[model samples]
Target: MTGPTGLGTRTITPDLARGLLLALIAVANAHLYLVERPIGYRGYPSGLTGADAVVAVVQMVLVDGRVFPLFAALVGYGVARLAERAPESVVRRRGIVLIGIGALHGLLLFPGDIIGAYGLVILLTAPALATSSSRGLLAMSGAIGVFVVLLSSGASGPQGVPTVPSIAAPTLGAFLAGHPGEWLVTTLFSALLTAPAVLVGVVIGRSRTLDEPAAHRGRLAVWAAGGLVAGVALGLPLALAVVGVWSPTGTVGGVVAAAHAAGGYAGALGLLGLMGLLGSVSWPGRGLLAAAGTWSMTLYLSQSVVFVAVLAVWAGGLGSSASLVTATLIGLATWLVGVVVAGLLARAGHRGPFELLVRRLTYPRARTSDR
Candidate 1:
């Protein structure tokens, strides 16, 4: 069942799940590069057209903070899959590789990168998941939840992207073409905010539900339903506020933020469960998505490349001019390209270039045949 630094069983669902996740990541990230308006919740743009307002509303409710936790869940699942065939050292080494790549990625292109956060969590939690009792891990998760609650409790303000006077798509150039120190602070804050979701992902990984989702459909169904309901109940009001429907100020705002902080993760888990349920049904383009999942790292890095080229001031300079509809189209195009290219690469029997590099780093002495 083992493959060097790769999944042991080659399950289609996890990769398929990853494929869908990349699209969400693309949409979630599109807002950060926008310069036409002030930043709103998690970098979503403000001053919307009717269409943009609707897009923002949908994204806030479904896309914003939900995607990364699902990605983290997949990462934890990958670690678990690796554990089934390799030693703990192997998992740790892979985590180190991710950290290095993530750090470099954040410094060079996007400061909001979640890969680094996931890497830190892997380094911190791999051992615990391997050795701790389920109760112990649950307790640890509870502690992390409390910390998240405390960190988010101070939110009593208007809901929107924070306006940084000196920072814009141009200064984003600093991250893309400059040094690590420039973006390090932003990167650190982003990583901290992402840590709780990563820990929750680790717990889900231990469940082994995603590992063989078909066998656990009933349980996943309940989780999918409950998580979906909880997520929407907490998320909808916030979305409405972002689009100027509801007021997210004062105690109401603080409560809304807390709900969002918690509900985003719930939504992510619900999506994961839903995806697992859908994994059982036959679908078109399933193979393409599976391939994209297998090549996720390469595709993820590629997304930043596309963003910089299309949006950065020094490049295509679409930053302020690109509307939500335009951004959505760009994101869709990027995702489609990722799926197609990944499928072609998979068909050619080649590992993604970045994936191969990571495997080599993770297992330096291991031969290609081992993979």
Candidate 2:
């Protein structure tokens, strides 16, 4: 049998999606560091008006709870590809390595790290992922979907009160003290929340949906159109509530939040389908975007580094005073810089530092020789 497709032969769609949507990840994460404001739903600061409120609404609709699922799906797709060429042990090793890296990242830099959670999910689900039938995959996804909805529905915070303050730690000592517990809890929770998307991505990868978009154009178009429409419509109520256009209470609020979380999966699918559709086309800066995607892991970690340097109180001390608008701009600028750096790296024939690390640990010479 043919071995797995190498990076040189990998499709563009997944990387392209990662490259572009990572900016949304940056934007979504940036505001969570704003320490001076009262925290509200979904970690956004409360009592906003004017540009900040508008930005909040837009973020809720387009960015929040959306990018990560898409990334989880991409990771799943990658797992599937690896399973095709390597033993299950290798896949598990990769997941383990990611968890270790994520732990360090969480404790030292950002407590909101998802890499460890992804690793946990992969470690737990690798068996099913490698051997499950399509029906089995769908069943797993359905079960996880229900869990996500229930979790989201039950999630609540006192208005104008920060639920997770460690993310905005006021001092180096405080950050070190608080992040370990915070990381542990959030990593587990994130694993549960993102599992459904990852399973669905496995199904997509099995079908080579993104890899062979030309063969699935009609289906991709439908997913792109329907998923986006449904995602936006479902997310609108929650977005409005976040902006204080209307206040939802009791059952209404729970239902709205549940719907928003569900919509995030649809949004992820829509975005992936859209990227698949765009895979064969040429555009200005497409290469640069693809390069960034290729170096996604490094870029992801770099964002946290930059955010900590510029926004953390113990570092740049801007988080205590930065407005939502300022945070969003910073996110955009960070993404732009990352893209340029990724492009330069690609031109120089270098892999992302983190990617290189993962590859080295995942495919050691002894292991490869044995295989």
Worst window of 10 by summed lDDT in candidate 2: 362-371
lDDT of 2 by residue, 188-295 (tens): 999998988888888888888888778899999988898888888878888888777887888888899899998898888887888888875778888778878978
TM-score of each: 0.90, 0.95
Candidate 1 steric clashes: 3
Q: What are the candidates' C-alpha RMSDs?
A: 2.7, 2.4
